[model samples]
Target: MTLRLQPVRLASGNDDSEAQLVFAGNALVAVLTHLAEHHDGEAGRWFMEAWFGPGYVLNRPTFASLDKAQDWILERLAEV
Candidate 1:
């Protein structure tokens, strides 16, 4: 079972803007984080508007290492 991992671009960059989302997706699901850290306005914005919902606020788990990143992605699979 090969996972088709693809990078996710949060926005088109040309100037000083928030960094791209440090997240990826496979055929089954996509996992995301606030990028390098949490409380990231842009990342949080994308999660709320795109994946989760207006009222949903995902904050507890964040990617810190390679293993954690993978876990984060798997954890979000249920939502997808």
Candidate 2:
């Protein structure tokens, strides 16, 4: 299976903004890990919101392997 990376632009007040994306699972994890390690809390939160959506519900087993995560995302995409 192939995973796609789609770009997203987020607006933060007037003139301020940030850019992010929903990438292939591995890519997503890599990006998040980098942000978590390097960026401050607000930046990390912004990235998470873009990736998971604002009303995202986090259940148990909050994270998964890249392949599993990609599959899960693809399944959800199919539903929409």
Candidate 3:
């Protein structure tokens, strides 16, 4: 399977607007938001804002980078 990421700005009503739309092939699989400075220790991490399809539910909500997030997403996708 192929995974793609599209940069996006979300109207999340907070400083955490910078995000990425994660797609598995042509299907959107997840939305990952960048944690804002207000998040303190968690700031600058990637947060799983949303997920779709089977086996996408997150056991961990934060990732150190988009690559890590995608790795986790791919693992879940593969499980289905």
Candidate 4:
């Protein structure tokens, strides 16, 4: 399966505005937000802000990078 990421800025009214829209084919799978300095240890990581479909829910995990987030999304998609 092929996944595409579109860079976007979320109007979260905070430092956590940088985000990406994750798409699987024509369907939107998830939204990933970049953690800010306020997150302390998690700062600079990518956080799963939202998700669609089954198997996509995983307690809104944070990834060290965009690649890892995409990998996790693919794994979840494969399970369904």
Candidate 5:
């Protein structure tokens, strides 16, 4: 499948403290699974919520590149 890359960020109290990189697509399930396997449960859960929400549904985003996503996150971080 031709996949599109979208970037998402998770913020807690402020934009800076809890930021992450989220890859969206059919491939995201695989990616999230791998991340869950490698990272702590809390971190994985937070990402899942930000990207997939409570029902594990995809959220629409504007950016389509990893770099763009990271950049946006960093910019938000700077604001906090």
Candidate 6:
């Protein structure tokens, strides 16, 4: 099966609205990240999240911006 990272609409009742992550497939591979609210005013400190295999893992040293976060995620995805 091929892995895909497509934009998805956020469903209500979800905990992280600032960020959305969803995945489904037979191989069990996923990626997740968030623009945390806590870093709303912080500079050069953005909280990003990641989902590997069948679980979740947060990347260290958050990104500087949403663009950076997306770039980082894409880089990791390329490795998989």
Q: Which candidate number would show the highest TM-score if scored against the true structure?
A: 4
Superior by TM-score: candidate 3 or candidate 4? 4
Q: Estimated TM-score per prediction?
A: 0.33, 0.33, 0.91, 0.94, 0.28, 0.39
By TM-score, the better pick of 4 and 5 is 4
Candidate 4 lDDT (Cα, whole model)?
0.92
RMSD of each: 7.0, 8.1, 1.4, 1.2, 13.7, 5.6
Error of 4 at 37 (Å): 1.2
Query: Candidate 3 deviates by what RMSD?
Result: 1.4
lDDT top scorer: 4
lDDT of 4 by residue, 1-80 (tens): 98999999999999999999999998999999999999999999999999984654657899999999999899989988
**Residue-wise C-alpha lDDT for candidate 3, range 1-80, written one tens digit per residue:** 87899999999899999999999989998989999999999999999998885864646489999889988888888887
Count of backbone clashes, every candidate in sequence: 0, 0, 0, 0, 0, 0
Given candidate 2, what's the lDDT at residue 12? 47
The true-structure Cα RMSD of candidate 6 reads 5.6
The lDDT for every candidate, in the order shown, is 0.38, 0.40, 0.89, 0.92, 0.36, 0.47
Q: Assess the local accuracy of residue 36 in candidate 5 as a C-alpha lDDT between 0 and 100.
A: 33
Model 2 agreement with the true structure over 1-80: per-residue lDDT tens digits: 35665544445443224334555445552121112323444333322333452234355122233345455556655554
Q: How does residue 46 of candidate 6 score in lDDT?
A: 40
- Give the TM-score (vs. native) of candidate 1: 0.33
- For model 6, the superposed segments whose C-alpha errors exceed 4 Å read 1-17, 20-44, 53-59
Candidate 1 runs further than 4 Å off: 12-28, 31-60, 75-80
